[model samples]
Target chain A: MDKQMLRDTSRRISPYIHNTPIFTSHLLDDMTGAKLFFKCENFQKMGAFKMRGAVNAVLQLTKEERERGVVTHSSGNFAQALSLAAKNLDVPAYIVMPNNAPKVKKDAVVGYGGIITACEPNINAREEAAAKIVAKKGATFVHPSNDLNVILGNATVGMELLNAHPNLDMIVAPVGGGGLIAGTALSSHVFGKNCKVIGGEPLVADDAYRSLESGQIETNYSTNTVADGLRTQLGDINFPIIQQYVDHIIRVEEVEIIQAMKLLWERLKIVIEPSSAVAFAAVLKNKDYFKDKRVGIILSGGNVDLETIRFS
Target chain B: MDKQMLRDTSRRISPYIHNTPIFTSHLLDDMTGAKLFFKCENFQKMGAFKMRGAVNAVLQLTKEERERGVVTHSSGNFAQALSLAAKNLDVPAYIVMPNNAPKVKKDAVVGYGGIITACEPNINAREEAAAKIVAKKGATFVHPSNDLNVILGNATVGMELLNAHPNLDMIVAPVGGGGLIAGTALSSHVFGKNCKVIGGEPLVADDAYRSLESGQIETNYSTNTVADGLRTQLGDINFPIIQQYVDHIIRVEEVEIIQAMKLLWERLKIVIEPSSAVAFAAVLKNKDYFKDKRVGIILSGGNVDLETIRFS
Candidate 1:
């Protein structure tokens, strides 16, 4: 909630997470007419920024709670993040996933030493199963992106970026469940000098965009986005922070997201998921606003299936 | 050829090239049974270590020669490397490529501002065409991997690697016309403390291994390897260097190259061409010799067509 908490969160999570590199490309700069700094959280442990939040949440638990372990309902990067973070901290992790989740995703969670509990493929089922784990095992339950502790942890990325590039005019991130962007917004608000925050989301799953317009949380009826990470809607814990600190959200077309993802792979030569590409796509789509400006993009993750990457 | 020349080359090329990061992976260490330090030249300017050699070669030319400019015959990373290096040094570049070279390759050269001179798609014809340009225009010729100046430049990767981790037991590089490995061997001989150099070549095009065995530069009857950049035979200038200083050459199968390349893309989350994978593949293939040894692998390049990356 305060600058001191953000600083302490970073210090606490520093040993458990990577202070990922900030990369710049002259060719990308020439194309967008802006000096862009990419904070590559894709290179983070377990290949996502989610590791920061997972480690913070697990570390914040009481000794008794830590002994009991942690539980989270996730079928994406957060599952692997929590598992790895818990493994690093010498704590057990119970990951509850939908029954229909991909085997590859489940295998990665298991690979990271997570104990998997499969539930029916529904939000209610997932929460109920996680609650059962909490009740039976006395484990702590951590939300993927809605916990205050997790948001504080995610804010460290922005702190590091602003520390590296203090004069950045703007910081941009993809809006998924709003954890990253909300934390980014908080970091920029307190630590950045004259810096604004923006977020990019897929048009197919623009709940965050509509939420800002309507001044309330919104949901997508159909989660048909290629950016699988952004299909979830914002939660109460992070929505207010986004509303208060975020400047705006831009909605990009699916085609645009694919094009940006390809450019990242082809030009920057870094593997980034579609979710990470949304932020860069937003900058490319709205070049007029960002022309000749210094912008920082948080590449949120790099956990996509490489075999399925499409260039055309 | 000397330490002074290596130091001077570093100073001259530092402004024009990147001192790329060295990355390590615990999973890779476990897989190879060795502690590995990867010098990521794939992140170099123009997306390969070729930039180092190209820039060094261009800078070594006299001012009058710079005015007349540099020429090289190729259709790979060197073509783009030379063009970009020439542009950086304010020198004209004459790129003589076989007419049958891929359009995408030619486009990349032109994109870097190289003057295109189409030649017959044969070694003799390509050389004759480049020779005619050298005679008619008085342009200085730079071989892709056979010149001493370029070898000195490539040696800087080993110098930097050893500078970072001075106690490396071995340095490994993929043998492509023998420049990178030859330079690596020279670096270990001059600067390394008890460090040996090894070369990784495709079993399909294992001319370097054969040359070492035969005590003569051997050519591949069929260049059928996916490691396209490594298909050429070592020239007289670099073959002797390899023979003298290199400890041994490890030849890997095409399947092993693909496996290592996939591991790099999947676990390391970085783009690397099959050629670069040869070095890692060699490490993976020869586990007993490298087990528990501190080894440094120079990721040679990252210029691969994304449309065709495969793991099978």
Candidate 2:
């Protein structure tokens, strides 16, 4: 897609999404020796940037398709995002969540007006459940990250970031299902003057980092991470865009992610999930590379389980 | 003291303080049945509204007095605020802390360019330590909340709130040593258009409430409450102002404070100390009184010890 398409997608989803604010801290700037501008997608509708893509994808449906409604399988932020987006547009959303998914997750989906169909606790079970809904109900299936429409919708983040701070030398985001970073990469490539896009991934889930290094999509089997959102691997639709326009991917240890998250909670006073902290952790890890440079970091979401938060 | 003084304080501390943004959560509004506007002083400099008073007090000093520097006795947000404010003004800040004070609190004062003086763990000891500094080093002792300059400094919060949302039917704030609420009352009375000012106090340490009822300064012998920052009693400097302008004071139970704090962390997605939550808790407790009204709540600070934070 081109810059115009990204702009159009932004305008199309403008009514449904929030143009989240950019916050800066002089204390953080002094400590890092870099000018940092944080695009707070954590403050977005449904408390995640996924709303942008979900709203855009839902709005792109045909009149007949809209009537039939949308279907997706996610137990995380996307579940809530799609549910809310569909609710906003008066479209029915069918969510296929694993039976073992936390009750809170299920409640959140239901709270956002989503119809949840429980399946066995696995990716295969989730996909099968979603497929049945699509086949039986004629619901349009929307991939959480591997869809073109979702990427175009997610690109609005880059458009807003660049439009607000055009002099940013680099834009950094966490790699979660490769949607946000890929869309940001495409948007920056089209709209940026000299801005480079980078992705941050947990060392535990270094699929995106390995994918960039091997010049192909990569998969991970490990799910042991505080950044639960980044456990998802790169997809065929997003991998090529990432490989082409993204500068590099930085992998941070689990401790670094938690530490960055705590610092954000302590300093910025905003609640951000571990996934959002990964991008800031990457910036801290690469202090020499980012020193004295103006950098824009996307705080991807704030949908955290507060009871489970640990500072150690 | 007046609108012009409040305006001058706002301008004088403009360089040192943040004109903290006002945040609204539609979900919260829907739940509370009130159009709630949160003046997020939790995001202010030094992580509290204390910065407004601290900076204003420091800037109000004569050039010679500034050269002598400032001193305060506290183990809370004010200690950090005064130190940071003094540092920003190129003045030395002497902080007198109880020897039993947490190492973290001591470290924060030192981190903000304050010279720390350890004393016995009591109010008399803290005052004596600060008095010694004044006698020996010619430092001006800045009260955390009781002094006229600090009250005028805090009045800026009301000025900004009213300036941003002039149509607010009522403004609610927490009463801690009567600085914030008193100043807020003065500001709303001077600058607001028929706006009423209200104070929220903890039932456990309901000195302000009793003082309002008896028309005398009351003391709290037991500080067995979660809102650590609001344990102090109202002083002569601010009590009279509060008595005259503040419409009423609402006292909330400890359970309500914790519940309000959790809701803010969960829904508003911002970290606020228990003292800050008291105001919102009061609002929740008085839902019948506040329903369908345009209310502004000052989130006083975000300086909680995260490890000790327990929802239950």
DockQ of each: 0.60, 0.65
Model 2 residue B188 CA deviation in Å? 1.0
Residue pairs in clash, model 2: none
In model 1, which residue pairs have backbone atoms overlapping below 3 Å?
A: none
TM-score of predicted chain A against the true chain A, for each candidate: 0.99, 0.99
Model 2 TM-score relative to the real fold? 0.98
Residue-level lDDT of model 1, residues A36-58, one tens digit each, is 99999999999999999999999
lDDT by residue (tens digit), candidate 1, B112-212: 99999999888999999999999999999999999998898898899899989999999999997988998889888888998999999999899899999
Kindly list the interface RMSD, in angstroms, of each predicted candidate in the order they appear: 1.8, 1.5
Clashes of 1: 0
| Cα error, candidate 2, residue A192 (Å) | 1.4
Which segments of model 2 are wrong by more than 4 Å? none
Q: Per-residue error at B227 for model 1, in Å? A: 1.2
* Candidate topping lDDT: 1
lDDT of 2 by residue, A1-312 (tens): 677788789889999889999999988998789999999999999999999999999999998999999999998999999999999989999999888999989999999999999999888888889999999999999988999899889999989999998888999999989999989998899888889998999998898888888888878868688998888878999999998999999999999999899888888999999999999999999999999999999999998888788684
lDDT per residue for candidate 2 within B1-312, as digits (tens), equals 566777888899999888999999998999899999999999999899999999989998899999999999999999999999999989999999989899989999999999999999988998889989999989999999999889988998988999999999999999879999988998999998899999999998989889989999999867788999999879999999999999999999999999999889888888899999999999999999999999999999998888787664
